[model samples]
Target: MITSAVRQALRTRGDEPAVLCLIGDLGPDRAELAALRLRGNDRRVDLDAHGMGRPVTVEGIGGEGEPSSVGLVVIAADGLTDLRRAVTVTTQLPPTAHLLVVVRHVPAHLGPLVPAPPTIDEWNDLHELRVRRFGNRGWACELCFPGGMSVAEALAAVVHGPRGRRRGPGVGVLGGLSGTQAALWRPGDVAARGVTATGPVEIDRVTPVSDLVLRLDDGGGLPFWEDVEVPAVDRLATDATVAPEVRSPEARLRVYGTDPVSRVAPVDERFVNPIGFTKKTKGPLGELVEVEGRVVVRDETCVRIRPTPDGTVTENDLERVRHLRGVRVGWPEHGDTATVRIVAALAAGGVPLIGDPAPMWAAGLGAPLAELIAGGAEDVLLDPLRREEHSIRLRRAALRTHGVRTRWRSLAAEAGLPVPPETRVSVVLCTRRPELVGFALAQIARQRHVRFEAVLALHGFSADLPEVDAAVAEFRATGIPLVVHEAEGEKVFGAVMNDAVDRASGTVIAKWDDDDWYGPEHLADLMLARAYSGADVVGISQNFTYLEELDLTVWRGYRSEVPSPAIVGSTILADRVVIEDVGGFRPRPRAIDSQFLLAVTRAGCRVYRTHGFGYLLRRAGGGHTWNVDLGYFLRNHTEQWIGWRPSVLLEGVPAPFGAQADRHIDHPGEHVERL
Candidate 1:
């Protein structure tokens, strides 16, 4: 992937200089550099003289102003007649840019004054190998910074005794995570060794886009010079942390962590967790055998990880609980259980966690480790260390087992339909926006689960809705039955949908909103979830919406991994009898879906949630959203809705297409009806 990325970078650079070798004031032969410049785009600049510890002045040759920033910096060690000038130049480059240091031999002169990088094993031979690959037996050996370190750090690596915070706690954390490549601050000069260490260190800055910033000391202004190398799988937002507490089966376990009971669980009445958390919600794994299975799971019981009689701990224990959605476990009775050993090993490696109990507590496994995870006086007890540990090993295994990369074709097999497409399902699509009717119709035409008819209900008359009627006429060629309903006067959104449902002659009536988009397998997923989960009304309660003004795709409901009494809205597929039981949708200008779902729940209708199977609610500044507070709506603290990945209820289904932010749908292809 890295090689391909580098190649793509070269390709995209076009006519720009691909390799700029700075050889003192003149830099590597300008003529050679010019030829090295990647194809077509003619963009080049020069840095005549560079100061090692100081900044270098840049001259922009093109119309572009003195460059705001640059992407790469290359320095030749042999041309370094002045060490101070070299130090100044590298420090001035962007923190994010890549740096390359070319050398004929290891420059021992700069080692003591600057931080040393990881030792280069057989540096001469390695250079010879690369030089051969480039077919340029040039007398220079080049050193590229590993893992995209900041240019500042790369320059520091050229010098003497500890150039950074050599004594602080961050050193340890950085040491543990880097494995054998950790160049840390120890007594004199820490060498790259596999230091196994773990503890809770404080996070100085949660810079997700770049560095894993840490606070090395309790005093204000902790060392900013060093950073921890967070594994890609272990990285997570500051707010997202795991809180696990062990409890006796009879201990009356409420919601775990800082999650509110109302939001996470049905609260004896409601469902769904507050944002930034999860509650103990369980459902079938959806691993169907031969035929699809209709499974119902309301067991909110947290999986208990108890100590063995001998109080032994092992990797096997962690694996045992790996598949569980939520878990509760006490500290292993044996003082040196596998959990304790893992934490100790990580601490020994210099990777200390950041949280309430502090690094020392975890370093020693002092008292009960469960206390660390259960320390939620205000909110969730965020144990990032424990969560990351699982991701580093366990989650990757699960991902590898499912070798199939997600795509439309692979997803088709995953969508395993419980019943064939010939089974009729009615989609009551209500729309007030004539301009976007084509968009809605386009999605309807693309649904992979085909045994459905479209009941296109336009709120206004045909005279005012020329665009809608035009789309309708265009779709007439498609063989799929599309029953058009043109309301004569202004009608409420709920009334329009309810009237369509009344007129539709299918056993299943699916509610659909015009602005919302869906995956081709959406209806199929819903129908399967309803069939297998034994749900009276099944749909994606985890409503992922696209915020048009913000240009962001977001999920509103809290519990996205389990079932809850969520306002599933348009994606809901209700049995005709269930709709009648709820007395149909109450007609109002707004909050119609919410009102109807509430009625359904109150009337004893079973609402099952599905995963991200493409029920994208397109939220804009105008329209029905006027009824709610935008801030609260965006943050999603407003309500508790229960739902999980559609794959949980329905077996063998990949994620819905538009569920990912980048895979967002914006097309309304030819609306010609399929015959």
Candidate 2:
């Protein structure tokens, strides 16, 4: 029987599917078996295809009193003719409906079209379906599942398999990976096409339990509807730390991050507060790096403050000092009382102040500006709003920096291996927005790490556009290997992206949105995280999506829920191998990222999140193919704070804010419903 967890996961309403029908000239036993296959969930109107000729039509089934309200169509295939008839009938289905095909055998001629299961077609005497695939869209049926008698019993067999069945005496693959996932999956091969099976094995597991490769449920097992690959972020984390390492007593911490100052214009009112101006606050820059020598290495975040020759604290410079990732203070040569009180203000605000700036001196903190005055002159820190908003933000960022620094130090000390594996990346850019594409292409060029290539898929008019041609020309001029794939059609986001992946030669495939801000070190950091974590996909742990029109920062869930994770986000970098196994992205245009993430996870591939890459996601308002509209975002997402970031003003795309996206205005507290 399925365990409680599996049951909860596969929860069903048990209502009759809207329209269930019998297709082709089938025996009575086939229909009964189909109903029995559904068992507890059986509620179908056996659509009698009485008068429907060779190529069955939806109209023919409805005329015979079958409920024409189609939601699902179930067909039992007895032979080659039945299969072809079902394939044809499916074309008439509403785009949203699903079709279930129960096939005893597939026509050998059609074998090439299917990524048919290894040698399953060779088994002539089998009584049930062994593998499944769609002609082009969505799921079709396999009536019978792997290694079980009937459909229901096959589903119940999922959680009953024995785990930790390893050849070695110690523990199994699950034992190597310690977590809830390990407990749920067994290390040994559970299915007939086991990991060790000869012939075609799609992808090998890095570690047995971590692999968790799921086959397409052809026949049975708790709704084995799709093949899945769940990424093991936790496994990546543990493996990174525990892997064997060589002695490197003096490994220096490398500084890798992109500053937001160049992108941000000081003119925006949001950056200019009543007391001071603001610079973007970066996260987790305070990781420990091994520097040679054992001279009392205390902290990674400490930064020594540098001042002007005159040594007087400026009004705007206070925010600069606050933005620094450390707390240890080192006075300038021409130090004055003003700089002292700025430290005093920071200390009074509960920001940690340390006695020594050992680590700080090494990190180089120099210069000052007018952002937040370090001068205790006007006592601007006394302003209640300033104190509530600015001070809290400063304190929180400093604390997080301190915490990350400490954690890294501990990890570095415990790590067995000196380094992790690095995978080459191929960034897939599929878009109709030429300008944004150019901008994204430029940003890709800015990445510090050069172990990558850009595979761009331009659809519709973009393929032939002159401006796009020039941009492509310019990118190739830089000696970067750029490959462009073009198709003439309306947008299908998933399909286009999948096409790009098919052309990519990199070890990791990075999915990038047309419009988003990524720092120069973005690719480097993602690769570094991938090496250190061994995660299938590495992305920034946390990200914020800003609405350009509303000037509001939107979030769907807790801003802090994902901390130091091992997966990628919408702009993701996934293992090219895993992408192949999961069949790349889905076919639809809308909600494609969501669909991709779900299918990959279901296929037992791991998605892990890493520290931030100075990532900022943007929503340009309505006309967006996906769900990030002003109304949808405001209604669905929780507002983190009233904040805005620099605009992605780049070349190939249109006036990004105008024709590309729609905007909604709030007129002095206008009701949302009215808008």
Candidate 3:
């Protein structure tokens, strides 16, 4: 498809200078093949495939030396990152240059080839590409090259011809599967089944005027033959046998999607609104939908319902519940698969589901999540505090069990793929308090499902201190690697952290706090979020805080699991390369976490905030670098507990060493100083 596009461009340009810029994961072998194919047609076409940072020379193809202007620029990109690189290269080219962008996997929603206005950096470039509206030209799909048309003909239609008429919103089904297994799926669902699926195709709304409509009868009572406009189906083709009466001979179907799993990534509740919606004034209840003889509540109120249709819930249904504060799920009679899928969708978004525990547990939901399921709608609907607490616990369960990555991992295992290797993490703990060293190391020791090393940076203290030596010895006995670094007393906090990081050897680095409480699966959960979200940095929100002086545990309902500008400093876990790319930790005495997050964001790197279920930040009187007062946490808290009540996800975590003594310390400032 790429070679044909190139050939057509050459035909139109004639003797004009042309350059082909290959970007992304297109391997050297594929690049060489593409170059060879282009050159084989004509010896005059001098093309060399270069990596993004390298310069491309259009020597003999354009002129004797480097040509000042090129008539045509072909950019073939593999993914979003490559597209950003293409955008950069386009800016350097002549304004009059005819641009052609070929993406291997075009997002289903992109309508045209015209790129959005470029941003100041690559991260913004990617964000723009994701959310920007597209026009009807400038991009072509390698997968959906129109059949029976020459490259020149297709290019003319795509670039110079009139814009294609926009189809109605909803799915335009072209073919039918055998027997009663016919399922009306969105583009993402089809893509997950290894078929090329495209669209913002709404399954609930399909029009007879749709170019390639399929007649679906799933044996359910719901109306399947209703004539409704399915707006904006760019193109879709399925391998299922075509229905003779509905098939259009001239109408070509093209489906596009990144992946089925990735389709849910945007809706992953963890990454949605991190701020708690509990404090907001309640709005009027919205429309309600009935399914399976039950009133499945659909409203703008605090408690929403995830309406399960007769069959599987469509992508549109998922979108409806995406921002919901809490979802009330009722038993769906639609088989086990549908039930599991519905729960997964709800849980994946970090939204708490209020339903009977028995059904959810039968469907394989384990503890904490099962515990979160309310006995009845009235249990949480009448109490905002109960709902908010449930949301926190549910978010934690989502990270550990219901995440998209976790689901895929389970599927992969069922298919008999080899288990993936555990991610290696270097825990960097920098602190001035010698008494809290053992307490912090104990938290690191409890971490599971990851290979970890401890890098203890004793800021303003010597390693020879008995407390420091004893903590190191105990941690090393756990068989995990330990590296101790002692920074001079005068060193800045950020400088001390960098020194410790320098001595660490792990693919990923996790910043640890000496005085904070962490769950056993904290690092593992961060790893899961990292793998699924593809963010440069991952961290938990500072949701749970223990006010030592007041003997109160405050649950600050901070938004989590979404891309944000910043996350709690100590909860940060980032790949070493990403940290290095952003120039490591800034050399500052205070607010280094915020500073580092800012630097990375400006560098076009993503910062993802995962759940705060496993981490509990400690706030004593003065002495801390964060320096926020006790009342600040109290003011923002959605709920408060009298004793030390962390999320159930932290159940397996051991109690902090010297917990009783540390609680009654006279010099709280000297006893708990985080470097």
Candidate with maximal TM-score: 3
Candidate with better TM-score, 2 vs 3: 3
Sorted on TM-score, highest at the top, how do the candidates line up? 3, 2, 1
Tens digits of per-residue lDDT for model 2, 1-675: 112211221233123232244433333545454534333333333322321111223332345665443333444443322333233233223221333344343322122112122234433333453233433321233322222122112211211111101111111121111211121112111221222111122344552332222121111111221323432111111111112352122221211122211111011111111122222234222211222311111234553223221121222233334443334343433322223323433432233233333222222111121112232222323332222233333332222222222222222233321222334678888777655555566667656544788898887755456556666766777777889998667758778888888898887788776667665556765554443233455566333566777666654432211212323345577677777777877788777766667776777554545433246566775556565436755665533556553212111121212221222222212211110
Better structure of 1 and 2 per lDDT: 1
Candidate 1 stretches with Cα past 4 Å from truth are 1-422, 463-466, 555-557, 636-675
Q: How far is 447's C-alpha from truth in model 2 (Å)?
A: 1.6
Query: Per-residue CA lDDT of candidate 3, range 440-551, in tens?
Result: 8878888887789999988898877766676677778779898988889999998999999999999889999877878888898787667545467889878888888887
> Where does model 2 exceed 4 Å of error?
1-422, 462-464, 553-569, 611-613, 628-675
Better of 1 and 3 by lDDT: 3
lDDT of 1 at 304: 25
User: How do all models score by TM-score?
Assistant: 0.36, 0.38, 0.56
Q: State model 1's lDDT.
A: 0.39
The lDDT per prediction is 0.39, 0.38, 0.52
